[model samples]
Target: MPSQPTLAFNRDHIHPGDRLCVAISGGADSVALLLAIHAANTAPRESLGVGLSAAHVHHGIRPDTESDADLAFVEDLCIQFDIPLHIHRADIPARASQARETLEEAARTVRYDFFRSLIASGHADTILTAHTLDDQAETVLLKLLRGAWTEGLAAIHPIIHINTPNQRPGKILRPLLQTRRTEIEAYLHALNQPWRDDSTNADTTYTRNRVRHELLPQLRTFNPSIDQTLANLAELAREEESRWQAELSRVLPQLLLPGKPVRGGGRSVSTAPGHSSLSIEIERLRPLDPALRRRILRAAARQLGSRLSFDETSRLLALCGFLTLPTVAARTGASLHLANGLRADRSPREIRLYREKQSANPE
Candidate 1:
């Protein structure tokens, strides 16, 4: 389509002879991806000894129309192209209720869960998905509408990390991120291949769908280059996020102070609270840059298995600054109780984030 190398994805994420598992949905983007990868494997290039595999996830909703030969088309494509295919059916409604997630989120979770399992079972080295530049544009806009921070702006990473607890962590590569949807459709059209058109894509009730159909068109009137501009902004944020994450990883551990020791026991368990406690000396933490300080605190909260939202992270940062001074603590200890069983306590010595603690205003 574009060129051999550009057609597939960034080669840095997948090595020569590495087996790649492609997530396909019988849609144009995914069909184009599989076709592109197939083309790459057929051609002669340096570091081109790559293996191809496909997976189709059936999100068990709207079964009335979903049963229309989508899987059969994928299976036949894989058969014709000689690529291995894995088909999975998920109970999205039940899964969503159990996880307190919406049906869309649940479908995503199930799909990725299966993707990670493939890596764990030694089936593939990397996961490739058909996320395009337009998807990146939509993601950036969606995050912006939700009052996102800098990290949120870093949408749709080309090489994304996959952390499925208890399974081997893997990475997902998006080869078509630089390509537009129109290019993908054209690529498939050039091959005389037909793809399943999911009716759900046109449903404007979904926020992403609305953003794609309504907001993007309106925004295009102001700046015809809005998609490219948004994509560029995302790329810039991704570079900055990489640097910031590396720095945060280094600084967060150093600021942590071990919790006080146990009173008595045969073998005393060292009460050193790691990043999970969200605890640090007020004197030790107060001197750092506000940005760095907040990152550390956020890291601690994440360690405890709860990600602090942008609003929550902002609220907790106020405590980091205010609690370092005596006037904030005053008499009996002051604390702020937050969601996810998090409690930020100030004892005039250190600021602590712990679970199952009631806040005392101390006013």
Candidate 2:
């Protein structure tokens, strides 16, 4: 039997009456989380001060035996703990094929959709997932390797607010984000509890698994505590990103003008019928520092329901004549089309970003 390990759960954001649902995948981290919460509810001193339930998403990625075993394990575990369980069966393969996404992406999408449904149905207000310190480290490394922006470096957020149109926002919490995978396994072993292992987790074909097994081990040779170091980097990035967001909130209103029809200065500009757009004055935008300019452009796109990548933002900058030495030829009347029907047109005085009208049928 493994020695008992101290399990830590961050319940600071959890409230007394909040209905909490633990997302258990029958894996070590999630299983440990469910067990720890159940134990805490039984002990007043360590209690989360909330009612607890469990949810499991069967991705159905592998053979029936493997997937069925995981579901059975989770069901039995939940029954043993006397916790109400919400089970979702996701056709991940079909979802991926239809959505043109990878199996991993599809699984994540469907799983979160189920969580949101639980929130919408009032079954739970907050969903908890077992994202460990190791996961955070892997995420940070992945982002770094991918040349991510500063915000991307802030990987594995502890709290994610899920906002649906006209509905109260729900939260997804990572209560075990600071806990290590080893610690989680130790905790389960101490209780003589078993967990199901997903075969895909060992497949190096997945980028994350490669990072976990190959890259992280290689980095450990250089620094024994690389995981903690990377996790600290993510913390720092998250704090800085929060500050940047506050700064942007203060700066955007003064610079951004709504896309509503405007007629003045001998200029007439309006989006297509039933379309919305946002425009920023070229003169005001050009004089600002490059960093602020880029952030403003991205923020404006976000408001228009689109996220601009670094290259896309840079292209927009050049289109707005902000680039001193242009890499891509950007001139007036040059319009850029982006994902989700978003279009950017550079006028004489301003650059307007709007979603182009979508046709009901296309050949």
Candidate 3:
């Protein structure tokens, strides 16, 4: 039999009077995470105190198996451990269509939103997810396939601040981030713990499932320790991103134009009826390297609640340089209308970003 999991948590950030809300899906990884923490709490560990609870998201996508099976397992598991279980239900298909996102993307959004609601309502302070090293490897592979940037290659952070609309921010911690999937299952098996398997995990039609079952196996054939390789890559990336983000933060203020709405100026006007605009001095950006320049522009776009694709970022940069506005060719400036109502206008000195007037309601 496999040895029992040595339950350990990164206790530096966890505090007394802080309630931990573990996101349990009745899967082996989550089951291990909760059970380990509960065990620690039972023993009155200083780090993981007795304040342990769980939140489960029931995405009723599989009418046959998930609607009843998954939830029943989680409910039973929580009861057995005597942990408080908070259940939230979401119609992932409907959410996907309404949000114009893929079903996977919609499910993720709904899950995090549920966690945020729990925090906003004072139900839990720290939200924990059971994303293992295998999951991290799978994520890095997915991002690599999609041509991700350095930040994307970082895979997942061990902890991050979670925020929702009008809600006070809270932290989400991944205690089992370094744990492997096989190790989780072994831990559960050693405890004779039972967990429900999601029927969809076997569905190769899903990109993640395919990556796990197909691509990962092929890659392992080349490198016997592919999982470790990917995990190491992610760890290196996380450290690099930590340093890079700090530099990015320092450089952003210097590049932003004074009295021209650049860093934190995208919120108020974007929601209001009238037009909203922000500007960055061309001179400040011109001195930076191309990679840094693109990063700055991408950061600005993100603040405005719009993520730019590679093509979009490239075209936007072109607008800042030589591209002249088609309609306003007679003028010295250039204008490029982007997603939502965001309009980018560039003069010789500065580039301004704002929402244009739209007659039609977004609803």
- Give the alpha-carbon lDDT of every model: 0.78, 0.87, 0.80
Displacement of the residue 173 alpha carbon in candidate 3, Å: 1.2
- lDDT tens digits, residues 187-212, model 2? 88877888999899999999999999
Best by TM-score: 2
Off by over 4 Å in 3: 1-5, 44-47, 64-66, 164-169, 258-274, 320-343, 361-363
Residue 73, candidate 1: Cα error in Å is 1.6
When sorted by lDDT, best at the front, the candidate numbers are: 2, 3, 1
Superior candidate under TM-score, 1 versus 2: 2
Ranking by TM-score: 2, 1, 3
Across residues 111-158, which tens digit of lDDT does each residue of candidate 3 receive? 998889888888888899988888989999999999887788889788
Clash tally for model 1: 1
Candidate 1 structure, TM-score to reference: 0.85
User: Deviation in angstroms for 256 in model 2?
Assistant: 1.8
